[model samples]
Target: MTTPLEGLATIVGPGNMLTDPTDMAPYLIEERGLYRSSAQAVVRPGSTAEVAAVVQICAEAKIAMVPQGGRTGLCGGAVPAGLDRAIVIATERMDRIRVLDPVDFTMTVEAGCVLASLQAAADEAGCLFPLSLAAEGSCRIGGNIATNAGGTNVLRYGSTRDLVLGLEIVLPDGRVWNGLKSLRKDNTGYALNQLFIGSEGTLGIVTAAVLKLYPRPTERQTALIGLPDSQAALTLLGQARRASGDAVTACELMSRLALDLAVRHIPGLRDPLGTPSPWVLLLELSSSRPGGLREALESVLSQALEDGTAQDAVLAESGTQRQALWRLRESIPEAQKHEGGSIKHDISVSTSRVPELIERASAAVADALPGARPVAFGHIGDGNIHFNVSQPEGADKNAFLDEWPRLNRVVHDIVMGMGGSISAEHGIGRLKAAELARIKPDLDIELMRRIKTAFDPDGLMNPGAVLIP
Candidate 1:
């Protein structure tokens, strides 16, 4: 008779079992510092088979198990908070590209493969794996699929859900569901593979996936535009898309406060425009067929300027300029960190109502906290705004942070009234689980509970997560 710890160690090998507090430090914490959890051990499994074996042992011992990816999630989805009687099943060791079929436009990759690495692999194969985000350099593919991640590219390529052709998941009770098929069309009976795609590791642990790939873009046009307001962004997006034959891949909206913080705090970053505007939009168009993209972009941009759709614009002449423009958009969250305590909201309304959402939320938060600065920015292309509130100048960070709950209600009430999502791109990890339970309809909660029960009867699989314990 072997103990559960011994059993796990035997399956993954002793070295892969991190039992020491020092060795397990990295795995026990969440990315946003919201959760500092305790895990009995951290086991790294190099393959799907090893993961399966580890799960089986945990199930037999009645031990709770948390399936972890790169831990890049801001929400506490990967954090096993309050589940101290658990072990973290880290997938970092299971990284391997099983297959890359350029002809079929698909790649079979293990869960631990870093997203940027996969993107580079696709690029090397003369294809595009466009599920890119700021954290692509370190975030693993498994977490992306698990959260159904939406990034700057989602305006064009869609989210992680769209990019996945199929998934291979390890069930709660140690069963492996091998649905890793590369086919684009599979009218199979239940579409069970879709179950775990955005399940956030609650239903099951994702071990591998068949990811969709697109043709590599031969030409790209990047432009940062000054906008009069959020409504103007909507108008410009529609006009640009229609004029450019729907080549708009990304359109990010940034508020003045957001751009100002980025330019001021982020070293070596300067505002590209001569005159400042209330809002800025980073619009990018990419096409595999070259030669006409720039002309079309320029033509529409010129028309936009004349028609008052755009106030001012700066088109990237080189890769360096393109990168500089992106740094401004990407650095907003980091810049907010420097300003002190910040409360974040990853909310989304319909694409048409983005301006309303921004306006209402901004006003609501300001009235709630008069001096608080609103930093509104994100994928305006898809209606998802990272509505974050930076503390008033020289404010005590922790004291300001204490108002998170109150400010959340102020903004969330506005979002809910607009028929928008409280957690848009970021999945409802442990952090938002209670709010999700409170605001969602009873029937919606019931259906999700039933699904959770069907998949994880014992509640040992990531309990206290999306469907909180």
Candidate 2:
């Protein structure tokens, strides 16, 4: 028998409940179209009280709940699958910037606020909330906190966990745990906010958060460099960091093939160097106190080039030029998608071991899939590599995707052998649950389960998500 969704809808209002298949289509599928499942209904809660109430009602009726934000997650974390008795509680209607304090250097915002908008609000006040991702325009603050996002700026600012000061969460029993404080120093007991930051909505529903901010960067410089390979790139990175001190904000790496895909698939993306190389690095340096950071950064790059660590270089001549370079980096994923299907891996190792990791893992993948083209790129400075493989030209996508499991095993084995992580910035949603179960030690899984049972014994909050049943 289908439980009456009408009763719950009455509390929030008829307009908030979406039961029609067409109306709930967007929420059912994940971003990459990897996971798709139907829901009993989709609910939009406008306030924290409404969220709590929905949780309470769901608990009473024993209906599972999935908390969804902007639905831009690469993982199937937000998608509802094999659960017909569940309703997606989207925080879309709760989009609001609650408060901003320039003096305290913190911004308290509702979970539904878009990341780009939050950054804009802070920028308007002459401050910066440095949590940035490719999906920043569409992804919500709640999801960012839930995943503990790490982006290009992680080398300088750290992850989303570091940016959060406090959080307001709605517990499984429909009670609100208000910890939304904007204080810089609070050494009180166990810091509860950290637990929910990367919990993926398995522990509680994060309704709002107090985020840290910093003084805006006054000057910025960006450059593109050609390196022999990952080792040369690493050497160049170390040199740049030593020369510029803390000014090297980002150090992203790319392969020649990856750049070619961007140039061919994405419109108006031109190679600034007007030449191709086997490997490249996109380095950006910024300083709050500066007349110009470009000269300092270019001098460092010049030294690297002369030292043979960097073979060729192109410094951004203007702000427009800077965005142009970044555009190629940002368009890599989409460009790859347009070209062909790929097997994606977001793995991380120590910054010093990145070159070795890439070499070993890439060779292993190549051996496993004979003609697969490796398209590895990402924040090398922070050791997070989006190691993906595009299908060979005019190859069958089904055949390429068929090697997903074997490909993942080969890469993950190397990552684990190096004391690294399979999922770096991205959390273990439904996509990596099997890998998490296999690679994660038995003791670690047991401890995580114990904590989950202690917090939510019924297994109601985002059931069958991180933990494999």
Candidate 3:
């Protein structure tokens, strides 16, 4: 009798199937190292047909499957839940750029293509694939689509769902649905692609996609502005947008603590101001046509400073300067790691209510656990903030992490009260599954469950991700 592992080997050959603990170590650990995944084997399928075959074998043998790509997800969505009869289907081997149509402004790429590679390909073709994140260098496109990722550019180019035109997915029962059309406007009945875009592989396995592209920006301006508070930062954001005629591409907010962490941990990164303020905004504006963008940005910052909305500001004068500023913004999460245990929240509220949300949430957490550090920052242009809380200095790491549930309630309660989403860019993987159920309306949860049942009745596709079984 052929075992399931041997059967999977037959589909992708022996070298592609990894059963050794050492060989599978990389796949078993989540990005944040918060969870340990267990799998019978890690199978790498080089093509869609091979993926289908592997899925078919797993389905027939009643083995649960965990679909993974690059394994850089912060939410533990790609990690398995230590199931005895589960296997990980990694898409790293399926990387390929099938097509790049500059005329059509679309690129057809396999799921495993690294996001940074896609951006380079777009740049080479005089186009821009604007879905970018800190982990773009290692994160795969499949995972981006699975989570409907929102990055700094989401303020200009929408989230991953908006950039994607179509997707090619392998269903739970080994059926392939090739809806890989590059059309912009398709009025055909029900839009099935939307279902799997942010499903976190619960509905099906994403193999490839048709992504929308835009014209490359010929000119850009970046500014790091210090504000008195979140409200002042919000006011400065409005000033930037109005001054630049709404050409602002990114507006990120960083608390003083977040900036301090970056400066302390990341070498060569200095505070942009002589005296740090309570809050800072990283503002960027771009234009395909090169004409007075810097001057316009300077004018906005000048007026903001005079009006008391901005305390201090520095605009990037060169490409190197712009990248350096961005590095400071991107290094917040990594720097937090050196500060001991951290509790992260990716929540979003209305644009106007962002200031209040930050204030209330920070106060609530401080009251709950005295001396806890609040490092709130992220894409304020779209109202999404990474409201992360660092453990108090000298506290036990495990004990701080153990308070995750209690902290989640305190933060999520305020988010729900303000009509904000609990999980903004990060999908509801195993981390927030219970919180999702607790906060969401019963009817909404029932609808999601019904949809999951319709697509994966056996619940064989990513059993414990997104929707709880």
Candidate 4:
């Protein structure tokens, strides 16, 4: 008499199946404390075949399945929810770079390979894999593709969706769809691979991907510019892009409050500018063709400074200085944690309307939640601003957090009005499922539901994710 658990264990090997509460604890937890759920067991599948086998048994047994990757996802997409007796298909053991075709400029990697390891592999092969984010160290490639992650490099290289040439997905029915071809153009029908990229595992589990790589950057320039506002940041971004022949890699906008929070909390970080400014722009440019990048960047900054578009600027003269400037931009989120109960809204409008979005959102937050510190910052070049609102000084943390839903309504209303996405980079996990349903038109919601039902007829694949049941 073989139990379903015993069958899954047999498929992945007994050592890979974790049923002990202590061993399964980490897998059951969500990145944000917002979601927490239990699983029958966590099965570490080591290959696409193994993943398929596990899914088959679970499907036959009518056990719900949750596909979990690195578990570094901020949204609860990877977390098991809305079901009891569900089995967690963990991908960590499946990590292996299947192929590194530097000549072809594509790397076929398993879904479980850590993002940083892939970057290093690409760099060693004399190429660049530019899908970078703060969680690159621990986040896995599978989850990145699953979320269609947009990171710092999206300004230039585009999102994970753009970097992916192909994907191999485990369909909801325990079948493996091997679409891992490296070809740049294959108009062979519905583009099935793309359907799973940003589906957040509701459609299928991403098993592996053929990732696009670029020529390694030979020259780079990093600078921190003190700007009067986000509008100035946008102006400087356009000028720098034109001057550098669109070599601009990252254009991050940080508010005074966001930077101040970083400087105040994170040690050894100070404002790089000589004078205090209301906003700061962290601009970076990288190119395969070496030598003239700095001069081009300097020329743009020179003009901006002369015209008063930029108040003041500090260009990183060395690698160490570059790290320092980046540290300021990257550390803002961590610093916000020190300040109590920060509500984050990862929203985006058109690049041209970012300033107006910030202004309108800030005003809305102020009116809705008086004394809330709206830390507006992020990739202004791509129009994704992380409009995070910190709690009022001395306000109760839990109470302020209780206001998250209210504040979301306030901020998201304005964003929707301006034709912006409520969840830009972060997909519609459990966090925004209801909100998505609320705002999305009935027809749009119907289509999404149709897709979910068509793929996951049993509602077994990552239930209660992107589409609410």
* Residue-level lDDT tens digits of model 1 in 1-469: 7899999999999999999999999998898798998888999999999999999989888889888888999889887799869999999998899999999999999999999999999999999999989999999999999898999999998999999988999999999998999888889688888888888999999999999999999999999999888898988889889877999999999999999999999998999987698999999999999988899889878988899888899999999999999999999998988999999999999999998888888788778888999899999999899999999999999999999888888888888888999988889889889888878899999999999999888999999888868
Candidate 3 lDDT score relative to the true structure: 0.92
The total of clashing pairs for model 3 equals 0
TM-score for each candidate, following the candidate numbering: 0.99, 0.98, 0.99, 0.99
| Candidate 4, residue 9: how far the Cα is off, in Å | 0.9
The count of backbone overlaps in candidate 4 is: 0
Which of candidates 2 and 4 is the stronger one according to lDDT?
Answer: 4
Better of 2 and 3 by TM-score: 3
Q: What is the TM-score of candidate 3?
A: 0.99
- Clash pairs, candidate 2, are none
True-structure RMSD, every candidate? 0.9, 1.5, 0.9, 0.9
Candidate 2 off by > 4 Å: 1-4
| Clashing residue pairs found in predicted model 1 | none
lDDT (CA) per prediction: 0.91, 0.89, 0.92, 0.91
Q: Is candidate 1 or candidate 2 better by lDDT?
A: 1
Best-performing candidate as measured by lDDT: 3
